[model samples]
Target: MSDPVDFRDNRGVGTLISDLIQQVSSLMQTEIRLLRAEMGDKLKTMLGGAVEVLAGGLLLMAALLILLQALVVALAHWVGAGWASLIVGLVVAVIGVILVKRGTSNIEPSNLTPDQTTNQLARDAAVVKEQFK
Candidate 1:
């Protein structure tokens, strides 16, 4: 029976180092891809929040104009025209503030961060550190 030759005996330190470098390079590329994907998802979420804020602002503006006029006309009998208009304006402004606040909450720093990628990279670094030790 023929015996198989062992390849490990022929492998030098330089070859091992080269293989290590290649592995690290591949790992970095994969991490970068993951980072990009995570960032893209966060960006999409941010974009959705921004769109919601914009839509809310537009709706608020429309409501301010139309509802203000309607409310002012409706309540003008109970209060004077000017007081009714002022009250309506204040109410619409408050609602607009609430909508804006809700939309902006979704775009906070925490929500916009690539949390998964950050955690993954930290874990990877810890693993590499442990391996080196």
Candidate 2:
């Protein structure tokens, strides 16, 4: 009877497996880096929007304050008492404080991510599954 051929310790099996693992690991790392980059881009956009909103809000507040002061000055002049302007300024300041309090209470920090990426991926996977069906 012919001796059974030994197939043990095939040439470069370990090296091949190590190379494959390295390739897969590198690919996974690349994907993770891409995700982080996308997240950073989203965050930057959100920051820009927040800055614009802050500037606009501050401008509106300043304008409101100016109008309030004008109204106070006019009222004081009408009443022939310069000291009455201080009362108007105080009232406006109180209203501003209330608004600031309410605005701050409603604010919450957020993580910005693109909308529906996971859902789109799921849909794509379903389509692929259906193709095999």
Candidate 3:
């Protein structure tokens, strides 16, 4: 079991409070810097995903165009060329409309929230409250 805290001290309460305030102020600055760093990391990760998604989208677009063109040509031989072009165009449009969604899923603003800093701040607040009592 933990020993009980001894509140009696040679230092005055006023001095203790002043030191606590200074420490809390310094902690706040550190937390802010940590928040900034965490946010930067999230941004970098998001940008990397975006770049990969963009590259994949471009490659997929090219492949889809080729495959769909071939399909259209094959379909044109069976049905009319006009109908085949229309059908292939509709399919391509639908695929493109939903294409970037998966890649951009990581880029949400909520993901930038500094979870570590928030948790640390909560812990700091709890400690400060305990110290006051």
Q: lDDT of each model, Cα atoms only?
A: 0.79, 0.59, 0.76
Cα deviation at 22, candidate 3, in Å, is 1.2
Give a tens-digit lDDT track for model 1, residues 1-133. Answer: 8698566667788997788788788989998999899889988878877877887797689667866686767676665775666667767777777777778987888997888888888998997787575
> Model 3 scores what on Cα lDDT?
0.76
lDDT of 3 by residue, 1-133 (tens): 9899786788997998889889999989999999999988998978976875786577567657756776767666865664565566666555554556655777777777789989999998999899777
Query: Number of the top candidate by TM-score?
Result: 1
lDDT minimum window of 10 residues, candidate 3? 90-99
The TM-score between candidate 2 and the true structure equals 0.44
Query: Which 10-residue window in model 2 sums to the lowest lDDT?
Result: 102-111
TM-score of 1: 0.71
Best by lDDT: 1
Q: What's the true lDDT of residue 88 in model 1? A: 72
lDDT of 2 by residue, 1-133 (tens): 9798666866697886787678657755765666677777777766665555565566557656766766777775765343454455555556556555544433424445544454454665576467455
Models ranked on TM-score: 1, 3, 2
C-alpha RMSD values across all candidates = 6.8, 11.4, 5.2
Clashing pairs in 3: none
Off by over 4 Å in 2: 1-16, 70-111, 114-133
